[model samples]
Target: MVSISDYGDFYKMAKRNIMLAILGFNAQKHFCDTRERMVSNVLSSLHKLVAVDPHSPLNFREVYTTELFGLSLIQNLGEDVCSVYVEEFGREISKEEIFHVLVHEILSCVVEPDWRDYFPYLSWLPNKSFETIVSSTEFRRDAVMNALIKRQKERIARGEARISYIDFLLEAKNSTQLTDHQLMLLLAESIAAAVDTVLEWLYREIREVCGGKAVTEEDLPRLPYLDAVLHETLRLHSPVPVLPTRFVHDDTTLAGYDVPAGTQVMINVFGCHMDEEAWESPGEWSPERFLGEGFKLADRYKTLAFGAGRRTCAGSQQAVSIACVAIARFVQELQWTLREGDGDKEDTMQYTALKLHPLHVHLKPRGS
Candidate 1:
């Protein structure tokens, strides 16, 4: 189990690198002209969607993921590279895939872009029926890495130093020795685990907010109700409902029972979150419970969204920031209603290990 403190550095590094990438993308004049301009365009588009009609059909997740991914790529690779990359890969990009790619890029910037340098095993093609697809992916990734490395080398040779994620990783004077394969595995693991978990929370919050009145920048500060809703949703439907199993280091007594060392303990976080003793109307969707003195649904330590001890999530802050921004923008832009004849309640109450989303609903333009 990793504690929050242990992961603080990781969180800081991810946040810094991701933001830098966003800024870099926006600074490109050929495509965006200015960061503010690009942001304004997106914001304006969102507002237009919101004002046009309360029931217009809009895929919030699709638009949000595309924009976010586009921004990240623009920052890290510039307009030309981002354009080519998207043209080649965008059609294949699902929400989960976008999250995976973004997480990998961010992690590489912070830790080691040449992580595969240590783990050569990852570069080898495995003997599998889908080897062709796997090999193609590997080739594409290697091409990107080679391009980045060449750029760095050119800067060095020209006596012009550049500060980039890759540059920082290369400059780590004291680093643990890891094989190229291990480094690739580490990078892959970070991306796969972090992205989907964060997206699940993000999608849930955005859906909830978009279910109500339009949300705008002016309404941001006053949206405690929205914040409360997000908090309550997270508490009720944690992405990873089952905490990782912990092995006991020593024999101990628990609830008057003796347990031997080496025993594995599993905590049902989902069950605890819904315990009648812990929360009132445990199964209902009430954001009010998370506000002010009523915010006692569960103990902070017991909230297993971030886990506990040494193994807690390392990207909590980044995840929250992404979710908050996406949700706010979505609410500000789109107006929606339950499908006709479906009653007044939301039908997106189901949960799965993958994600939680609303059922099909028709939305027409508010005025048209």
Candidate 2:
């Protein structure tokens, strides 16, 4: 229960969360070297591949995840880096499979048209297909998450001090009232924050903004075009497109229709951002729309990237910060090219957000 007018508690929680992950300025100092080095190596290798053969298709699923989230989990965070993840209640699973399962789970929770949702009387009956997915996804998520929890437990028992998202959350669990399930979900959600799918233009922007210098968090604000690109991206391909929902306190009218009290209402963020009335050409990709006058304080609603209003995402700012800094730095250091020969139009990908198929790209070393 929180006041709609106040966000102090939310801000405090967000502040504390920065410590849980390999996030924020102070905590980043500890593992920045490993993460940066790994990223640099990956970028260099890609650059060599593209330089050798420009049209070679690259697999970006693992590549992107490893850069943004995996290093924080595997290299210095989770134990048994060589061993695959396992569950306290289920069996073992591989690192490669974790992100895929996470996307599936996210898809399942979205407020799509379902008979069971509209008709509570049919609740007893289950959609076998969906049931199977849920059953499978629950096990996989638990397997990956539970395995991490167990590893941290073992580390604690062996008197080994680890500074990782897992360890940090474990210590703050009690004070923050974070359950094992909550901790697992936190890690689960972080693992699938995919912002590296689009690359070419961002690289150009970063290079231009930094004047061939390496992009850093401090350089993010000065790079106005890069900032606009991030904004348009979230608006177009929001990975998490729907909010959980809230109960209506009283009767209300919505677009001339009456919404009764105690009704569960959800926000379709994707729909909001895609509305033709709100956007000149919603379907097209245009970061230019967010430049100059678009970024005014009152104009934030054009893209409901992280939800809207007081009930909006608590970590919206942090999420954008991470995406901008990471993508900018990556783009600044390396260059990527689309490989059309490997496959046809990747117009439709079947992931949680309907993203492009993870494909290989040619890369070249960057002056920046």
List the candidates' TM-scores in order: 0.54, 0.75
lDDT (10s digit) by residue, model 1, range 47-89: 5665576455554445444555554433333321332223444
lDDT of 1 at 295: 63
Query: Model 1, residue 76: displacement in angstroms?
Result: 8.6
Q: Please give the range of 10 consecutive residues that has the lowest summed lDDT in model 2.
A: 1-10
Each model's lDDT = 0.47, 0.62
RMSD each, Å: 10.3, 5.1
Q: In candidate 2, what are the lDDT values of residues 94-153, reduced to their tens digit?
A: 555554555545555432345777788888987876666567767766676666667777
